[model samples]
Target: MPLVRIDVIEHRRTSEQLRELADAVQDVMLETFAAPARDRYQIITEHRPGRIIAEDTGLGYTRSEDVVVVQILQQGRDEAQKRAVYRALAERLRERTGLDPQDLIVAVSANTRADWSFGEGQAQFLEGRL
Candidate 1:
């Protein structure tokens, strides 16, 4: 399995909203990648608006407002599949918050199946090779 890791750069998202974001990403993976609903891993980060800087043509590099960045890390998948999943992700975000597609940038990191664990000293997804 190619481990897909996601890093989301966001601007001042509420705690509850952050959780929703994680779930949304998981949903996308499950639907597009054909991953099981139980097979899930997501990380959500919230950043202060004044702290994060988004490049806008106007405003001369001001802080971003109401923006979310999603990073995804997954395994056991190819590039085409990964890109498709990302496109789906962008659409979901737009549907959720009326945000511009440019506001969300998703990049999937490819990883080997050897580096994953679900619980206490367990690597079930690894098929016990480790």
Candidate 2:
């Protein structure tokens, strides 16, 4: 199992639109990754279109345009899987939100269970350590 964290940054035009877009993105991700619904985490941040500055730091950000960055964290250490997941979410988000696909940036990072902490002074996840 893996934990996913999604961060979406875009123009703060309307709350309804932002919420709908975020929900749709999460839906696509959960299905694509075969992840449990509860394991999926999405964080949406709204910014003014004029205030956003997209930079190309391998994540392919275009300056002077609003953007949405989707970060997917998984257990399996597969680069292709991450790309596929990001593309899937970005595609679905664009389709549902009517947002320009060019403005959306999808990035994925995978981590092992040992790397995660459940908080509250809990122990880290370890194989066969339960």
Candidate 3:
């Protein structure tokens, strides 16, 4: 399972727009990472103005208030798959939500089975329930 957190500036997008953005990311996860159909976990947070700040890091590209920062926590994904997810997220978010590709920032983190407990304080992956 990949747990995703999407952060965006408050008052910039409507609730429907947020769902569309999340759906776009989910589509990318399913297509590129091959995650399970029901294994979707996403958290979308809207921060107050000036609460989120992102610099270009000298990439010569400027970001606007429409920035979207996505953090993905997953396991067993190779570099090629990660790259594909990034590209797909950018394209899909742009097409679905009108978000600028340059304003989309994605970061994927690696985790193991021991790191997750679906419920009941049980380690499902370790117990072979996953």
Candidate 4:
């Protein structure tokens, strides 16, 4: 399962818009990342203006106030899968939310099954409950 964290500037999107954004990302996770059905886990945080500073890292692209930063933490996805998720997220978010591809930054990290615990003070994945 991928735990997604979407960060955006405060007041930049309406409540409906935020829901659409999350749905778009979840679609990519399910389709491209191959996450299990009903396995959605997302956290959306709205930061005050100027709170998020994402430079292009010399990529020669400009970011607007509508920039979105998506961080995915999961296990067992290879580079090709991760790349597909990035592309799918860009396309889906652009089509669904009017977010510029340039304004979107995606980062993925990996962990082991022991790293997760859905609840009950148990590592469900490690315990074979997942």
Candidate 5:
């Protein structure tokens, strides 16, 4: 399972647009990571202006107030697949929500399958219940 956390500046996007952005990210995961539809898990948080700061890392790209920070936590995947996911997410989100690629920041964290407990306080993957 992949748990996605999206952080953005408050009032930058409507609720509907945020939903679309989440859907776009999930779609990329489904296509590139082989994630099932039932694996969709996401959290969206809106922060006040200046609370979330992002720099261009010397890329000379200026970030706007509409910046979106997406963090995905899941099991390990190949680097190629991860890169593909990033590209797909940027493309799809841009197309669906008109979000600039420069404004999107994505990060992924890997953990063991045993780290997840879907329900019943059980580690589903480790117990072969996933």
Candidate 6:
């Protein structure tokens, strides 16, 4: 299971656009991470202009208000798979949402199966309920 958090500047994109972006990310996860189809979990947060600060970190690229930050908390995946997911996500976002690759920042934080509880205070993955 991957819990994705998408952060973007407020008023930068319409709701439909944001939904498409989320779908694109989830598609990449499904393809490269082999996550279950029913395991879709995501949170989208919109921040005011100054509230979200993203710097290029000397990459010689400038970020605009359209910048999107995708943070995925998921079970460990191999480096190759992660790389493929990143590339796929960027490409898909560009194609589906017209977001420039430089405007998208993706991060994956590794977690264990025990870290999740689907409901009723139960760790479904650990208990074989999932």
Q: After superposition on all CA atoms, what RMSD does each candidate show versus the true structure?
A: 4.2, 3.7, 0.6, 0.6, 0.9, 0.9
The segments of candidate 3 whose C-alpha lies over 4 angstroms from its true place after superposition are none
Q: lDDT tens string, model 3, 71-129?
A: 99999999999999999999999898988888999999999989999999999999999
**Best candidate, lDDT-wise?**
4
Ranking by lDDT: 4, 3, 6, 5, 1, 2
Per-residue accuracy of model 1 over 1-130 as CA lDDT, tens digit each: 2234433455456566666666676778888888864666664555544555556557443323655556566666777887788788888766765556666656667665656776687777667644
Instruction: List TM-scores for all candidates, in order.
Output: 0.71, 0.70, 0.98, 0.98, 0.96, 0.96
Residue 93 C-alpha lDDT in model 5: 84
Q: Locate the minimum summed-lDDT window of 10 residues in model 5.
A: 121-130
Better of 1 and 2 by lDDT: 1
Clashing pairs in 2: none
lDDT of 4 by residue, 1-130 (tens): 8999999999989999999999999999999989999999999999999999999999999999999999999999999998899899999998999999999999999999998989989998778887
Distance from true location, Cα of 10 in model 3, Å: 0.7
- Model 3: ten consecutive residues of lowest lDDT: 53-62
**Cα lDDT listed for each candidate:** 0.63, 0.62, 0.93, 0.94, 0.90, 0.90
TM-score of 2: 0.70
Candidate 2, residues 17-112, lDDT tens digits: the string is 777776777676667666665764666655545555566778754533446666666676466666676677667876887667677766566666
Better candidate by TM-score, 1 or 2: 1
Give the worst 10-residue stretch by lDDT in candidate 6: 76-85
C-alpha root-mean-square deviation, candidate 5: 0.9
lDDT of 4 at 13: 91
